[model samples]
Target: MKIPGSSLVRFPGNDPKLMLQMPSGGRQNTENSQLITAATVCLVVFGILAIVDGVYYHDIKYKLYQDKESILEHIYHTVRAVMFPIMMYCLFAHDFGGVLMIVGIGAVSIDFIMLIFDVKEEGRSRNRYGGLSNDEYMNHVFANTFHFVAIALILAAKPAAAWTIDPSFALGRPYPQVTAWLGSAFVAGGVIAALLHFWQWSQYFSRKVAQS
Candidate 1:
């Protein structure tokens, strides 16, 4: 199934609706360049803070990552702590061509894997910590919302450069023929991630019922 948001940036030229019109001359260059700058700044600063948040929250505050019950959190944070910056670098430095697609696929794949570990950890956590406190939930909301907005801006600012299938492939440096295959990887990763989360949520409610 085509992802609702994927249509926003999926293979560039498939449908007119999916394709964003590129501004000509100075406008296009200005916007895309600005996007690159913003993406760079946000990725570096926020990414670093995110790492520190993990250390402070998980390591110092609760020691969750080191706790056996939170092994999933430990593993997920360890992997993503390494991978997130790499994806950001690929987008900022690589000019959002095939390299971005490659990294995007990797990000989604890592997220899917993390969700698996998360579900297991959640089951254990529910028994121990007893779900998120109001403040904790609010923090989650703020952090994730900020992250989603940053990613959205990056995509919106440079849709053509961001995706593999652009009509202006002539202008942007298209990747090798294998570039198309990366699209497939992107889709598969998203699907797996969605399914995994769906299953995880279902398990969460089931466990809640059993506990109650």
Candidate 2:
């Protein structure tokens, strides 16, 4: 059937409604980007506030040194800590930003621990992850590992050319080439694992969507 004035055609059984419907993947991708952007922006704001409060509220109870994370806090410590190194990585190739990398990971670790306490790991959380098979589990693991690698890459590059580098910036730094390589390895390994998971999820997606 012709769609309009143009000669573009589709099968008689083609669904105009489904075709016109916005792509599911498109929506998901957009939302994911939005989530990341919001996360980044909020973390930046949180960091600024923390630095300001740490200086001004050094004696106040709400200083970041004492401030905690919760659904309401809107302060994503992990992102704030990581972002500094990530930005430096984008700027330079050495360990100048090492502090941020270490702090970021620590923040994430602490945040996760705090999260464990602040929220139940059941109900919606459990349900969201409930239907996973081995493949899905692997995929999740791989995806997260890649995420770490991506973050690492953005944190590890040096601030200047490698022809001349600083020893102080070497072995002890968080964004050392070694650590970044390890993170990349994890990303690759995780991708392989996630592919298997993707295969498993495909079956579920196909069944649920019901092509015909």
Candidate 3:
């Protein structure tokens, strides 16, 4: 019993209809659509929680930016801020193939490594505050869960051949309004993160000057 839509073929160019299709023009696989939608939803939640953690808890509540011990953690977030928009585009707004897909995968992989380092550094970073508070810790737990789930669903939805064939980077408006909204939000977040980092560094330098 051969599975329907199991044999994936690449559609040329950026036609919205160029997604995975059966050879005989049969019904398109709904599985990939479902998976992508699920992943998008997860990412939305992840983004919200991340903002709360970074902006509300870490910055406003704790002022981790002023802490020398938290510098490494902030560095991790700075890198993530730079990578976030690219990852969002590659994973959601744009369909990538061949070398582009490989590059997307590499970017996500690097983000994961940075996340691990950030998590490990959190202990030392938050030690002054008696470790992570219950609320912040729970926020991280949920954010990490959604982030990982989103990545898993994205990989599952993508065709294996996308990594090797038809090298293309084309608009993939899975949900145009949603994608646009997400793109705007992420771009804003990236900008804010950059500004916040600049502020952090300036404050650090000011303190050093004062001490000197």
| Clash totals in order | 1, 10, 0
Query: Which segments of candidate 2 are over 4 A away from where they belong?
Result: 1-122, 125-177, 209-212
Q: RMSD, model 1, all Cα superposed?
A: 11.8
Q: Of the candidates shown, which would achieve the greatest lDDT relative to the real structure?
A: 3
User: Model 2, range 1-212, lDDT digits (tens) per residue?
Assistant: 44565423333453332122112355643553444344333333443443443234322322222222221221332333333333323222333323443544554565455434423421222243353245434543443354444444343332222213221223222343443444354334434433533443455447556755
TM-score of 1: 0.52
Best by TM-score: 3
lDDT of each: 0.49, 0.36, 0.71
| Residue-by-residue lDDT tens digits, candidate 1, 127-157 | 5777645554555455545454555555555
Considering lDDT, where higher is better, how would the candidates rank from best to worst? 3, 1, 2
Global CA lDDT computed for model 3: 0.71
What would the per-residue lDDT of candidate 3 be over residues 79-186, giving only the tens digit for each residue? 776776667656666655555556667778888898999989999999988998899999999998998798788767765546554546442224446754675677
Error of 2 at 36 (Å): 25
After superposition, candidate 3 runs with Cα above 4 Å error? 1-28, 171-177
